[model samples]
Target: MASQRGRLTMGLVLILLAMTALAGRALQLQAIEAPAYASSAASKIQRAYTLHPDRGQIVDRNGTVLAASEPAVLIFADPLMISRNGIDERVSMGPLETQKAAAAPKAIAKILAKHLGGRPEDYRQMVTKTESDGSLARYALVRRHVPSYTYDLIKKDLAAGKWYGISATQDAVRSYPSGTVASNVIGFVNSEGQGGAGLEYALNKQLAGTEGKESYEASTYGRIPLGRATLAPAVNGTYYTLTLDATMQLTTQKALASAVASTGAESGEAIVMNVKTGEVLAMASMPTYDSSNLSAATSNEMVNHAIQDSYEPGSVQKVLTMAALTDQGLVTPDSRVDVPASISSGGGTIKDAFSHGSLALTARGVIAYSSNIGTTLLTRKMDKATFIKYLKSFGLGATTGIGLPGEAKGSVPTASMPDFTRDQISFGQGLSVTAIQEAAAVAGIVNGGVYHSPTIIKSARNGQGEAVKVPVSTSRRVISAKASAEVRNMMEAVVTLEPSRAVAGYRTIGKTGTAQRIDPSCHCYRGYTASYVGIGPAENPSILTYVVLNNPVKGHEGSGVALPVAQQILSVALPRYGVEPSTSKPPKAVLEYQP
Candidate 1:
């Protein structure tokens, strides 16, 4: 009897112990782990979505839109939501309701195809796609970059069914508003809305704003109504204003295309600048592609030739050589120099393009006639080292830092070289330069010897649409005001020679250049590069323009091929840009050698 009582007491204790343990577990679940459990449960029902910011607008100085981003949507779907929202009933009813429910995917696809422009079968496959666990896909991509108006219709139709799965996420689409105008300068963005080339690539940071985020309570298939909603608003990108003028850019491009067609040249580049501020008004390169249709363009057509490629600048080098000499008090425009038809140096013969006998000419006349021998002899006044120093100061051996893509750091002879190197360098050989560098160099003479790094980005607008900053450009004096003024007078002599002038009543000061393009295969002269760089209304000059033609098949000389094109641009551009005509008469020019 006592043993049986002990057994009963043990059973009671065991039962009491099990009950106490159950109570402790319930207390722990309701209190100690309650927050963690609630969080886990909420996470399954809550959706977090990323909000893409709108890319900034790119505009010209006149506020004309060049590139911009438009509001777009990313189409997505909730297959489970479509299945749960009685989509089966909408398709059909009757004894075959189960079979009808199975056909919901096909029926839904047909409706989607009506508005989305896709095959019904294709969308049906998407709607019925299963996950690894055999459940319908909760989320699926339908389309991206759908315009807002289109998504609105889809959203309205889906709303009637209590979130029937068709939905959209936020995105953006890049648009080039100006089409092919300044296309090379204002590059294109890829389908992913990323900048690819030109200023678009260079200044993408200011153009691509930061993304935001959103969190909301959601059902198994879509966002829950009247549920929690929290959002971190997106920060829109900053705006950029360029220095380019749309009118000038369009005009220059036309002139370049006409010049190339007429000259039978492979390609051409032209640049127009505000000399005082180094602002690029118009920069055009031929064989260009439309920014809106980038995929159709060849890589060659995408280059910004004015700033990207460097070529032997030929006689245009004399402009700087003369500038350096005059700055050093080595010669004046009227100082007399001896020039021969040809002179031998560095185991090679240097001569004028046209044969001439020995003659004494003023320094100004040497430039007007473009006598290679005269320039070589003139360089004897200064050593090779001094000449190189002047070239570096002209921004030849380094980048112009024009704040553009693919800017070439052109080649200049280093410390060690032969004596002929000096003669060659003096006349624009043994080196290379971009059209921008040459134009800016010429502008130095017009702007009283101060070389301003060429500028394209006028200002960066903040999110508030106020100008906060600008791209970096350096400006410093390289020659005295007097020296630059004299050089301008000398350049004027070149433009005003004999039966024709570069332009009438403009008092244009400029230089013509013709260089042999070395064949890449054998390093022998195979073609010619004709070019011209000039500034107009010589006194109080405001505009500096440069033109270069590669592989001219018709006229090869700088005078015949390049000068006329430069004249064409300046004649029309100067008058329209409001540059006043020169009131002073043309200077008495010693265009021919004396004695």
Candidate 2:
């Protein structure tokens, strides 16, 4: 009897202990860990947050907004909401509960079908299929990249519960006000709002502002109170005011296109820079791409030719060589030189366009005639070292430090140069340079011998209209005033004396060159690169224009083809800049030559 009682007591005690442990577990689950699990369950029920970014804007110099951003709506769905409403189970039943399951789907279909521009049956199929699988797909996108009108309609439908599981949050998108004007320079962004090319690529970091964060508490339905929110707004991108003038850019583009088409040439490029300040008033290339539709054009056509392509600058380089020689006082406008029909150098014979055999030529006459022999004789007066030094000083074989991307620093032959190579280089051979380099060098010659580093960005400005002056390098006197005057005078005579090739009523000064194009296969001269460089108002030069035509078909010459283009551009650009005709006559010191 005693043992039975003891066993019974122990059994009762064990049962009580087991019941107590079970009760404790129930309390812990319902009280202590309940909030965390409930919050997790709520999170799974609906989206807790939406990310929005402030889209960037691109503006012009005159505060005309080229590109802007506007608020937009983003659409999404909530799977948990549909599941809680038993829409999932009903939809999953297929043909059996198809009627009930499809009721909600049909409602969603009818509401969203118009927005998506899809058939009601299609929307039903898409919504039912997604709901059945307990999945939330942004089915049918019910309007992506939505505008304001569409957003209003969708919002009203959501408020009426006509479309379950649908939601929209605020977002921003890019807008271009000027349309395709200056498109190539302003550039565009990808869908993710990242800049790709042109000023966009050049100033990406500044344009792409710092992104911010949003942290907030939400209800089980993942819908926040209409007003209650903890939010951090994104910092908007900085505005860029370009140096490009929309009207001037358009005019230049039109001219370039006309010239390229009329010449029957492959392509062409042109730039109009301010002589006093290196502000690029107009820069353009033919076969340009629309920044809005850049992908539509080929890569070759999209490149900025003014800064990228390098060719034998031909007689354009003569400006530099003459500037160098005259600066050193080794040759003056009247300095006499013996013209040879052809001179042998580097296993090749350099010949003039039209040979002047054993004739007496003045320093200015050598330039006027573009005599390979006369210029060579003059360069022989200066050793190779001095010549190379002057070339460097003129920014040859180097970058122009123009802020554009893909700029080419052209080459000057530095290896295995024989004594004869000096003569070839003196007349703008055995060297290659970019159009910008040539333009900047010529600008130096005409702009009082000061070579100001070329610039495209006018000034870096802040939001307050206060600009931090981006200091341009001080213009250095690369040549004396007298030398500049002499070369300037000679160039003027080339245009005036050759009136048939000159623009009437314009005092233009320039040189024409036709350099033999090197044969890729044998490294011999097989074709020609034609170029003409000119400066206007020869007495007091204002604009320096360089036009180069490469490998022209049907035997083209610089004087015949390229000079005409230079004249056309000057006639139009000079009058546009309001530069008056020079009353001063061509300097009598110009040594006349018959080329």
Candidate 3:
């Protein structure tokens, strides 16, 4: 009886312990660990995929495609299929089976390396990466922007199961078809498919479209079966239409290239603007680059000098001073002023290009001859406040809003500055102005002294193909029509008919600039900036052109170097735009003073 009771007690205790253990395990799984296990299971089955949106085309005014996005592909892989360690299912395997599984990627790598130009060993590492759990990685990058032929070869292999786990998606590669023509204006996209510089950088927001997304049930082997997917479609980028004329832009670039080589200039820039409409017809810079391969481009090659750089503008600014004198009725082209060859103000001497002691000149003569001393004397008639006001009215000391990135607002001295600063700035010194700013300011004189902001983008279209309206221009009348006429007449005298750079049949008006360059490090005079700003068809001017040569080694005078370039661009542009020769005879220039 005692032995029976002992056996029964032992069996009852064993049964209680077993029941308690089972209950605890059930509680842990159903209550404590349920959420975590559920999350892990969902993670193993579901994934969210990114969809890339299509970028837009950048075209010229006449539908010439300057920049566009071409079809491309981005290659990816399913880690489970490519990586031995990525297989989640446990299977009993022998040594030979394991060895064969490990060597599969090596075979695939050899095939990929043949087309991609990388070593098979390097590719082997990319395909065999694993997760923390020693399972195959879910995703891997192969290549981006693969050409059609290369992608086709890989796709064929993938379809035949010659390579497992590889896949590709539709993508785009940005291309500049014109190839180095207007590259500075068009800019380039970077390796990551983002706009890096120039208009590419400026209009990136409009050009880079919205990214799309899709969520679906994918197989453990990394295949999307298609019907279970939910997609949020991508919105494409807006198309850009620039005001640049392709033919004229090419002409201007060739002219700049020839000028930079012939004159041995460090760099050069040229701008052709519509005097009446403020349209930037063509802007060109030397040392330009191929926007396709910016990685090889230098700092100089990347800059859009026409709008980004500012120089002293030299005597090209004298036209503005002459116009100011005529506008206020303080002087006229006929009014005479006694001027010395050199004058002293603010303890600094201002001299002409040539010394003529106690000379007399009309206000127009000051501009026609580009006499610095004469212009300085003319400023004496107006107060400092009025003079500075006139400068602002002409769009100086501010950006011209030419729809480009990295535009510079050229510097101007304060109205209350010393007489030396005043004198120098009055004749295009002691101040900085960009080529576009000078062009727009000259355009003011061309458009009857009404200032209009310069623009490069002619029009634009949204992704939905809706026309995007350009911003309404804010223009203000700076001078009367009569004053602008006299200024144009004076400038016309600067470029005469016989033995002149002006196209024989067309009437021309211009100003020359030979300003000393200020070194950035020492702030001292170094080389020279030779420049010329001209207007044509003097009876009713239509176009305004500006050319600037930096540190010309061969010539120091504007007439010698810069004038020829200005004439070259205008001679081609005028005829291309169908501008006719002046029917009337050239007007007589009364350069001699009559007191």
Candidate 4:
């Protein structure tokens, strides 16, 4: 009887121990591990995706679109979905078994290839792709920026329940309606819809809007209908209104292209600036490729030559030299100087374009005739320190601050420069300058001496059409107003000397330049750069046009190759912008002085 009681006690004790262990396990599960398990379950049911915002439109001052973003879709593949469906396993079994694995993938790839312009094999490879770790890839990009209409057709097939891993999301593709027009300035976009060059790349941050996030409850298949969700709305990019006039830009490009072709020139650049406002109405680079078809473009053709290329301005730079001399009272338009056929400086003989005996000519006559010897003789009167200072004040040795990518700051001769180098720079040989820099410097000389920094962007607005303030271009005085007027008068004499430069019904003034081109291959001068910089209605200069042709085999003179292009642009731009023709002719310049 005692043994039976002890066995009963042992059985009670065992039952109590078992109850305590069960209670402990329940507490641990309910208190310690419950949150982690709950989180794991939630993760399986919730998902988040990025919502891309619309990129901005780049438009001209008059609201003409230059670069725009069009609606499209990004097609993607979920290889993990293919793996989950057992197609991956079948694909590993060599097309023998029912060929079901190869069949599904082939069908999907074929459909994708038909809609998109890719090979079926390529798509199939992506669909069956694996990760770097030897596991099936969860995601793969089939194509980006696919046309929306094309995506629609693919979606129809997907809705038919055939396509398993194929999917698409709304996206954008950049479009250039003007084709190659202003391509060098507007730039192009890459396949990923990112700015690849020019203004597009420089202002990419403002052009590319902010992306947002969207999270929602999703099952193994897809997002649940009316499931719990959270969203952060995206902000679209700002619309940039540039100072470029689309019409003028097209006209300038056509003229420049024709000149380049007719002259058999390597390449060319042109810029039209508003003398008063410093607005760049047109900036054209020739041999430009269509931004829409970037693969066909060469690296040389993609350059923004107006701002990127720095070359010897030849005589076009003489405008600044003459302006500086006039401002310093070192020379006057009517002052007379006896010019020789050739003058020796730093072991180099500087000669005029035409060989002539000693002749007496006024300062205005020296500029109009483009006498190199005469210019050098006059430049020698100024000290090196003063001359270099004047060059800097005219916006040389620095960038024009036009706010474009890859802009070059053309170098200027300094106080330490050799005497011969200084003399060469006086007539635009030793110095290097960009087309835009030259244009702006001339504008400063003719625009009452106030140097306005060049600018392409005029205004900016948000996606909601609200104006965003853009900093105004900086301006400073570079010369006296009287000096500017005198220089304008002197340039007017140049047009008088060459009737070909004169635009009918308007009094024009400009200088022609022919400088030996520097070849990068040898770092030596090989060819000539013919250029012309002109301003119209000389009494009150309104517009300045600068054109330069590189290595023209035929008609290598500036007047022959570059002047016609400048005239063509001015003929349209001046009237188009409503700068009235001159009612009275400019004062007659006394070219020669009789002793």
* All candidates in order of lDDT, best leading: 4, 1, 3, 2
Cα lDDT for residue 88, candidate 2: 40
| Top model number, lDDT | 4
Point out where model 3 deviates above 4 Å: 1-40, 84-100, 132-134, 158-161, 220-227, 469-472
List per-candidate RMSD values in Å: 3.6, 5.1, 3.2, 3.6
* lDDT score of residue 56 within candidate 4: 91
True-structure lDDT of candidate 3:
0.82
Query: Model 3 over residues 197-256: C-alpha lDDT tens digits?
Result: 888888898898888887776654564676356788777888988888988899889888
- Poorest 10 consecutive residues by lDDT, candidate 3: 83-92
lDDT of 1 at 207: 81
lDDT of 4 by residue, 278-333 (tens): 99999999889899999899998999999999899999888999999999999889
lDDT of 2: 0.69
lDDT of 4 at 393: 91
User: Which regions of candidate 1 fall more than 4 Å away from where they truly are?
Assistant: 1-25, 83-101, 104-138, 153-163, 220-226
| lDDT (tens digit, per residue) of candidate 1 on 393-440 | 888878888888889988888656678988898898888888998888
Which ten-residue region of model 1 has the weakest summed lDDT? 84-93
Supply the global lDDT for candidate 1. 0.83
